[model samples]
Target: MSEVLPQFRLLQPGTAEEAIAAKLASPSARVCAGGTDLMVAMRRGLVETDTLIDLAGIEEMTAIEVNADGLHIGAGVNLRRIAGSSLIAKDCPAVAQAALTVAGPTHREVATVGGNLCLDTRCLYYNQSDSWRKANDFCLKYRGDTCHVAPTGNRCRAAYSGDLAPALMVHRAEIEIAGPDGRRRVALQDFYREDGADHLALDPTEIVTGVHVPPSDIASAYAKLRIRSAIDFPLAGVAVACEITAASAHRFSIAVTGTNSRPVLFEAPDPLTGDDDPDVFFAGLNKLVQKSVSPQRTTTTAAHHRRLSVAALASRLARKLSAA
Candidate 1:
């Protein structure tokens, strides 16, 4: 095991404004929420920093509330809070379900929903130690210029591993960010990019304040495939949300994670019925899902297998919601 270095200084900010000021003053400083991911990266020498800004001490950023408009989950809200809340389970089952898949009890206790959404993309080759990577010339996601997952590719092929991001995207959630310039909001779907290196679109100086989940009568579900029942990133995950109306009209949003650079939200046709059979709506949706996700090869698992299973995952979840 690598020894913990003692050179860094810690700053505990009591408010969101203070945290923002502290971060801006030390641009290279690492922000610590629950420290679940940051601590692991620091211990493994994957992250190098001179200062740490602890956001956990900020009072306003830890609030979680449901109102007449929607749900507002503060950035510092922990995974355990999301998982154990009756309001979360009742109002946003998809988000709750995604939270349930995040690691184990200790991990959940120390991990935050915002941290999970902003997690660093992962790859087997890039996730290794400096010594291990140097021995293999490194990969595109690390030091080498070429992507080991796809040698001829021009971009890093690191896979996203978040469990909550997809669920949020499918729900059409909005993100609230604060910086020196003040606060601004954007669709959660627009907050990410399709490239591993610049996955998040937020400015370096911006700190996510909270996430707003809009009110909807839509039904939703989240499903994930992983090697274990706990404490593992999904090999492939899917989230589906749609509305069922009096006119029998159907409007849907689907997002996939753990298989691409960022979550992809695609629209499927209304009624979603097909000529083959009434049940063929799901069959067609399964096909649509497969066509929408273009998963590239990565160092974790077989890219093709993960990509192909996304549609099935979505189809299964959609069927379950339809029955409910």
Candidate 2:
């Protein structure tokens, strides 16, 4: 007998209200914006949804608006637009920096912010096709009985590789979700549940509408470390946003991504204190980063390397932030 592909129902709505209704009516359905992450997951057979609700037609989901409150970027805006947006660069520089590191120009042009936030946590084992996974007895992230990367690990070992998330977290960004219950907003930090499969806390009946980034008066920057220059997920990434107080004082927020389950926020230290031979201060920062980056060897990179790189990347970001 010839094998048949799994059947699925499709719903494309022209407005946000229709999309919300369709989502609530079919709780098992999945949402797609740019389709970059979803398409890859479907090809790998990781997504079990039999129905897809495309949100691309929803007009409100693709418009960017700015106001006195802050900048509200539509969830469907592509990485290319986000990266090239002068407003985002001036107001949310960290986001622009992260967008620049997401992929090459092609991916940047098509991948949406919503897709990046909702990106499936990746694992070397889970990214393989079904046939390849079946041959290796599968892995915890997939249908396997064991975690190929960490045999003793009780949970899936996939890494949260999205570059945009940490930058948003550092900015205290909020995400708007539309559902049968209307709409609600939550801090982007709370959107993640710390589990690979259940990483997203979004309701099945909800569609991410947009992201609200609060205005910042100071300077910020983002740095990512990956095996390749472009189109590669980071082994480690850092976002630093700082504000200068009166009397030439400064306060900063440091966040890390691609090295843990979610963005790891660090307590900012005085970058000026270690001016003369900053080795002592760097040593302290390194120790703190080592404790902060709890990485698993789920992908090709080892846990040891990821942990060390966290400190290195943090140092680099600190220097950049200080200079800014």
Candidate 3:
């Protein structure tokens, strides 16, 4: 990592409209909510920007409101607030739990919801220092022609390791975006694509303003497997949301991260009619994730290891939540 930080002109916008105007004025400028990820990438030489549009001064982006409809969280709200929110904790347990597990305490204090959602795809080969990447001939994500992870393929294999996306996916969330054209809402899952090099479908002029999760009564939980319990990104993360009543598992929506270019949301299977065997139910889930999750050699850990862990974490969370 470079010891010195890169210098850039920063633009502070007081409102979302102003922020959008600033971005329009500077097409190459990046919209920054919290600098947790952006600053690091800037210092690492992964990102080169002449201007940064900071959203910290936008008051509406920091607001978090819960009502009868559900939770409406602004993009700039810190993860710490979401992790400790009573409303979010009760109605959307998985969302709160995922927020609590992001990096460490200090990181959560500044990392914003928007930043996490729009996090850049990561890979061991691509996230190294400038000199290190140069010596290795850089990867397809940056300035190279071939992807180091899969030389034969044209697609970048970097993983989308964000924690909150999968959790929010299980709750059926929608993202609100503001751009040069106007404002629009899209399902959270639709906001991402399969390509790691350019996973988000956001236009250059667009800015994610907030996330809206409709009211839900399902019991949900999140669990992740990482090299370290804190500070490290997940090797594989799973979020399970189940609709259960009278102590029997009926329906489930499972989502996985860190194993794919974008978080994969598995479609819920046939409703368990209270007589389905636990072993059979879980076995099917394992097959579902293994068949759909195509984990490449992105991390130091073996590809198969992440695949198995993704299955295990999903099963564990499903079992626990199904019994809730």
Candidate 4:
């Protein structure tokens, strides 16, 4: 049987201020940009809200500008635009590459960058339709007492499955958020919590306004392990960004996603000195990545497989960065 989205009121706000006001009035109201994740959650009964504040009409949130500081991507800018942007490709290839891997062409046209960053965590047991969920009690993310993924667990173990977040984290992106009090910026890496139910570090009235990626002469790459080439969430993903000089790599940052409740970032203690043997450097990097993550059975893939996939991807990306 086909599932239908529950009835709800849609509120399209023309400005960021208006959107915040609407959310402040009704703290339970859900803020939607692309509606890609929200719509699916609504149909599955994973999220329920009487009102949805749409940010599509706000022109300020749709601009992509590259200035002296770096590239500034408005929260409402769609994935299609990001993937096809020549400036982004040259300035931050990892971001462009990551954006191109999100879902498929049609999904990218409607999915906004903010939506991808703020995507809801996923668990095999928590993402089923309403009817299927009812047969075996709801998970911790939905209001039930226990999490099916970890039966005796006290916290939700839904995996963070976004592709853009890890890429942005490697670039050291900062997120701009606006709320009733005022506006503030947070490092993208610090914006997510380990808890799946309350993953974002955002108040009910707050909305992400933009993402800022500072300019740097860095080489970056992104890789992922998924069930299919298109329309499937990644089983594991890795992104690497670093300044590669003739002798060594400096300011190296590696981020892993889709295998844990929250994305993990590993910054090298010091520059990887010496360029004689790239193979040896990548071998150590793979081990470091494998040790950094503690994977659980949150998705269809086995925990060990997810960990190994992340390690392999990290190695592949390291090789690319070394060559660049």
lDDT by residue for model 1 over 1-324, one digit each (tens)?
353653689999888788888888888888878888777777666778889988888788889998898999998898999989888888778899999899999998879877988888887777776677777887776557777777887887677889898888877899889888999989998988888877998887788888999988878889888888767888889889877867665666788988778887887775643233536788888888888876766645677788778888888888777667
lDDT of each: 0.81, 0.79, 0.89, 0.86
Best by the lDDT measure: 3
lDDT of 4 by residue, 1-324 (tens): 247888888999999999999998888899999899999998887888899999999999999998898889999999999989999888888889999998999999989988988899888888888888777777778857778878888888788989999988888899999998988999998999898888889888899999999888877888888999887888888899887756655556899888777888987665676644767777888888999987788887898999988998887877777666
Q: What residue runs in model 1 are displaced by over 4 Å at the alpha carbon?
A: 1-6, 273-276
Candidate 2, residues 159-264: lDDT per residue as tens digits? Answer: 7889998888878899888878888999988888667766888877777888998876867788887888857898888887777766465466777887766667
Task: Write one digit per residue (lDDT tens) for candidate 3, span 172-267.
Answer: 999999998889989999999999999998998899999999987878999888998978898889898998646554688888899899999976
In candidate 4, which residue pairs clash?
none
Q: Note each model's CA RMSD in angstroms.
A: 1.8, 2.5, 1.6, 1.6
What TM-score would you give candidate 2 relative to the actual structure?
Answer: 0.92
Query: Which residues of candidate 3, in runs, are more than 4 Å off?
Result: 1-3, 245-249
Error of 4 at 173 (Å): 0.4
Q: How many residue pairs clash in each candidate?
A: 0, 1, 0, 0
The residue-level lDDT of candidate 2 at 291 comes to 85
lDDT, residue 207, model 2: 77
TM-score of each: 0.94, 0.92, 0.97, 0.96
User: Model 1 clash tally?
Assistant: 0
What is the model-wide C-alpha lDDT for candidate 4? Answer: 0.86
